[model samples]
Structure formats: structure tokens, C-alpha cells
Target: MSEPTPQTPGTARDDRLAGKVAIVTGGGQGVGRGISLGLAESGAAVLLVGRTLHKLESVAEEIRAAGGTAECLAVDIITDGAPEAIIAAAVERLGGVDILVNNANMAMPLPLSDYPDDAFRTAFEGGPRVTFSLMKLARPELAKRGGGTIINLVTSAAVRWDAANYGVYSAVKEAIRALTRAAAYEWAAEGTRALNVAPHAHSPGLDWWMENNPEEAAAFVAGIPAGRVGDPLVDVGRPVAWLCSAEASYLSGATIPLDGGQSRWG
Candidate 1:
């Protein structure tokens, strides 16, 4: 055999993830879509999992059109056995997973006294519950790979008290932060990195919020430092790319705020 070929620095970029895969929950829309595409643009095959097949397929189509590898799976992650089905499907299709983006969040932002019991139940069931399940499912795969990244998509409300109107949503997201820190202690030794990304609301989700409650839209828009709402790709996507990349290899159990200085509001 010829002498072993010397590897060049740049030539190995694609293979940086040749055998790796990523599963992005709620990747059909909003920040999750941004994360999924960002990860794929970096050379990893991605599984976009969410409740809406149409949205998932749209994101998947974009990824494929852009020459990236992606597949869509629609699963109601809040149902008793749904998380298991979603994770199992991704694991089967991808063979093994190297990254997990816990962006699937459900929330009902209502005042304490006016909060709907069903809404609270949904948020509790969907947010922290699903995060826990996905992490548990991804653990062995991450261990097999010897290194992996888990970024939990969080909202700024989890950090700032008096955040406009998200009481119950913030609580579960806070629980998610605590959950990630707890997991960091358990899995850091296994070459796993768990982190939280607190991003300001941006994307079609915001649009829906605005449409549903247009009266609050202007007030919300006025507070942003950018003087306008941010774009999910540029605002939310790039930061997620960094957090998921080897650039963040040294970070674990960390919470990063991508809030455009809005977190400065008291």
C-alpha cells in the first residue's frame, strides 16, 4: 500500500461530520428551523422533527434544495409515548446521532390568575418533559460518538423576571435550564456538552403572536434595540451554528442569551 496520505486541514471539513447526524426537535419552524439548517449547512445530515408535517417538509425541502441532507418526521412530542416514537424514528434513519437541539417548546403565556389549566398542563408536559426524554434518548448515541452537543432553545423570560407576559412558559424553560445543568454533571465525562440558548422571540411564531394580538405588537417592536424584529436566520441561526460547532467544544452547562440587548430592560 502507498504511504498513508497526509490529511490537509481544509479537505477534512465535510468529513468533520461524515458519519455524524443531528436531530432538531420542533425543527419545522421558528428557531428550530434555523438551527436545523445551520447544522446541515455545516455538513451534518439532519432530522427535522416537529408536530406539523407540512412545516417539517417545507424545512426539509429547503435543506435538500440547498444541497444539504435532511428528513422530516411529524410527531406530537407531548403525547405520552410521542417523544419515544420521534427519537426512535430519527435514530433509525440517521443510524446514530451526534447532536440534539431541544427546540420543541409549547407554552401558554398568561397571567397567573387568568392562566388556563389546560395551557399550563400542555406547557409542563411539552417543555421540560420532552427535553428530558430527548436527552435520555440521545445519551447513548452521544456516548458512542465520544462527543456531542445539546443546545436547548430557550426564551429570555427564563432569565429576566417581569418579562412581559409569559408566566408558565418561563417556568418550564427555567426548569429546562436546570435540567441541562444537571445533565452536564452526569454526561460531561462522556464527552457530552449540554447548553441552553435563550433567544429573543423572532420568526413566524412572532408573526402569529402579533396577528393574534396586534395591539401588543407595536409595544413589542418598540423595545427591541435593533429598531425592528430580528430575522431568524441571521439573528437566531448563526448563533446556533456557533453553539453547535466545534467552536463551542469547550463550553458545557452554559446559557447564552441571543436577545439583542432586550435583556437589558428591567
Candidate 2:
């Protein structure tokens, strides 16, 4: 286990979550898409939740094309009862829950004072609130499965940098990280597991940034240790699969950083 190498096979879709059902919030695009597909690759019945029905459908089709079972749920995860609806859909369609990836986060970067209350609410909807609500819903269901995994996908930049303007969003995500650890400790005896995957990969957020500022995007990539952005299937994909797999059975409540060593320099 200490061998500095992955025990699983390469990038081909594997059956790690063979009998599992997973719900991925904001599964339409970006980091959420990466994690959703990863779980599907592991053979989990994926529930892709997002505001964009078309995008969610596209992802679902891809999963089906790959011969994996998937379904699309379109709704703002921040909406009241959205999480509950998602959980219900999984139960009705796939039977039960085995894993959950909280991948929905409003990435509206703004100063603390300038950040509107509604924006803060939107951000919190995905950051900590959704996580809390989902866990509350999944707790009882996980017991029936004998155990399960709840993964929170936070951002590494929030912890490693001092972005004065980004503090509001960071605070919400940091709360999720804290919750991840707390849940890990409290749910240990209940056969429940939780963890945070803080990724600094080139996701839809980065693409938005680059599209707005080509210079800044180029500079950012140039500064990376690997001198390149992360690949969802290879970089972000593998770690997510591992965490959702039995191979990482002993891990829980870990705040893992998969940022191509971005946090290492600091």
C-alpha cells in the first residue's frame, strides 16, 4: 500500500463502484463532470444534477455511450429540496446510495463587502449547505449498504492563497472541508466515510478565466510545476476513482490536494 504507485489499472473505465449508486451535483460540466464520469467509470449508476438540462443530458449520453448506466437531473442544487429530490431519484431509479460527490459550487469571485447576499447564498448552496443537507439525507441510507463514501470537492486555492476578494467563497468551501473532517470522526462507527478532494486543475472555471484574460491564463500555466494544466480523465479522474473505490477503504475525512503540486511551492 505504501508502494508510491496506483494498484488499479490505467485510464480505461473500471468496475470499482460496480453495485454503487452515486449522485454528482453540478455534474453538467467542469470538475463536477470529471468526478461524475469517474464514478461512472467505476461502474456506479451516476445521477448528474445541474441547472443545464442539455449539458446534463450530454454527459448522461456520454456515460451511456460508454455502456455505463447514467441519468440526468436538472435543477439548481441550491434550490430547496433539490438534494432530496436527487436522492429520491437515485433510490427510485437505481435502488440505493453508495457514494455522493458534492461538486456544485457557485464560483462567482468577488470582494467580501461587494459580494451580494444572494451571491453568498448561491455559493453556500453548493459549498457547505448542500454538503450538510446531502449528508443528512445519505446517513440513514448508507447504513443499509453497510457503508458508503461522501466526497466533497473543494478548491485548494482557497486554503493556500490569500485572495482578499475571494474570501467569501473560500469561507463557504472551507466550512465543507471542516465538515468533512467532523463527519469522518463522528460517522466512523456508523460505517460511513467522508473526504474532501481539493483540486486545482484546469476546469471550466479556469477556461472562463482564460477566455476573459488570455495573458493571465498563459502566465498561470507557465507557473505550474508540471508546466501544464491537469487532465480530467488522467489527473483528476484517477484520484477520484481511487477514492470512490474499495482500494481506498481505510481512508476517510482526508482533505486531499490534487493540484499538480501547485500548493507545494508555497
Candidate 3:
């Protein structure tokens, strides 16, 4: 584990997660990268898992440069035996898993009527199926450590009324949400916590969309009450760090929206 230090003026990083081990899926880029950085900054050893070797290595390099311990494992989470392999890697490498971040999700946005079977299968296999598998495999390891935290990356579109062509995507995310809640309840006695996060943060995908369609992007930003897109590291990651720490020991199962008030969920 890395020792905490001052990250910026007036902000002191603490050793709240000192000696802990966290495994993050899709941890090389975007929100996943943000969370990985966050966990590392908070003094946890992070395992960065994703499909691209270079991307995972890049993030791992960043963590190492910042005096944090991190390892990279390149593998598609949707593949067979991936969940088992990930758990084994985490235990064999980082000692054990104290936190699991299921951040990799595959989905094709299409209307229910227009959605194809193969697309749906891809979404199903990549999202909730893999998430469930990882959670199932990580439970015993988590329990062995007296309990752990699981964070599932979800989407606000899952609860939106005008989801439109997001039926397939929303369904997959919603299923993950359900799994989070169920795990929160089922694992409570064991001290394991599970929660979902719906973050609307800037990413490479959003950057491309904004660059290609400024008007639409501007309109979308305008619709957000915060008046701007959230920073993946600050808005999404730091808060998630809190959630994974003792600070949020009492919080679990609920979906925390990091959209800067864009969502109106009760």
C-alpha cells in the first residue's frame, strides 16, 4: 500500500484504504481509469483489468509514478473463465480483494423493436452476466478479509422515461442495479457492501461526440443543471473513493447519481 500525502493545496490524502487491495474492471480508461486512480490515491493497491494491454499498462504506469501500487491484467471480462481468472490474479498478485469495481460494460443502443438477438446477447454477456460472475467469485475472498466493497458502474438512462433507443443498454444496466441491491442485502451479515453508481462524466467517447456534434453536445450540457460535464476523476472517482472507505460503511445498495443534478430520481 502507498502512503498518503497532500494531493493538492488544502486537500490532504489519507491512508483510509491503506493495505487494501482493489480490482477494477475496464480500469484503463475513462471512468474506470478515474476509479482506479482514486483507489490508488487513497492508498490501496489496484489491479487494472481491461481488454487492451497497452491501455492497462498506461494506467498502471500512472499509478506507479504517483507512488501507488498497481498491476495490469489484460483480458476481456465477457470471455469464459475471466471472472475466475481475475479473482485468482488479484489474490495471487495483490494478496486479496477488498474491493471490486465492475466498471466494464458492453451494450448496443437500439430500440426494443429494432434490437437484434446477437446485440442483446453481447450486452447481456458483457454487462450483468460478467458482473454477477465476478461478484460470485469474489464473495469468499471478500469474506475472508472480514468483508469488502463492490461498486457497479450503472447508467442513469436505466431509470429515464425517454430512454428511446436505449432499451437494450438500459435493461442491462438495470439488471446490474438489481444485482447490486440484492448483494447488499444478501451480503450484509457478512459485512460485504454493494452499491451502484450512475456517472455522467467526460470520457473519450463523450469527447468524440462533442467534437463531432458540438450543437448536440452543447444542448446536452445545457440540459444538465450543473451547466457543465462532470470530471471523471473529481466528480466520479473521489466520491467513489469515499464510498469504498470506512466513511461510507453504512451506505450500500442505493444508486448514487454523479450527473451534477442532471437526473431527477427520487
Most accurate candidate by TM-score? 3
In model 2, pairs of residues that clash are none
TM-scores, in order shown? Answer: 0.87, 0.91, 0.94
The stretch of ten residues in a row with the least summed lDDT in candidate 1 is: 1-10
In angstroms, give how far residue 233 of model 1 lies from its true place.
1.6
lDDT (10s digit) by residue, model 2, range 1-266? 01122233233357878989988887888777777777787788888888999999998887888778898888877778888998898888889888888888875668778988888877777678888998889888887898798899876658555687778767888899889999899987888889988776557767788779877777776766766666665567567878978889899988888876776422
Q: Which stretches of candidate 2 lie over 4 Å from their true place?
A: 1-12, 264-266
* Total backbone clashes of candidate 3, pairs 3 or more residues apart or in separate chains: 0
1 versus 3: better TM-score goes to? 3
Quantify all predictions' global Cα lDDT against the true fold: 0.77, 0.79, 0.88
What is the C-alpha lDDT profile of model 3 across 60-150, one tens digit per residue?
Answer: 9888888889998999888789999999999999999999999997896778999889888999999999999999999999999999999
Cα lDDT of model 1 by residue, 1-266, tens digit: 01122222121123344456889888988788877766776677889988889999998888788777888888888878876776677678877788888888788677888878888888988899888998998898889889698888777775565666777878988899989999888998999999988887467867888879876887776765655665555567656766777777888898887766776422
Find the 10 residues in a row with the least total lDDT in model 2: 1-10
Full ranking by TM-score? 3, 2, 1
| Better-scoring candidate (lDDT), 2 or 3 | 3
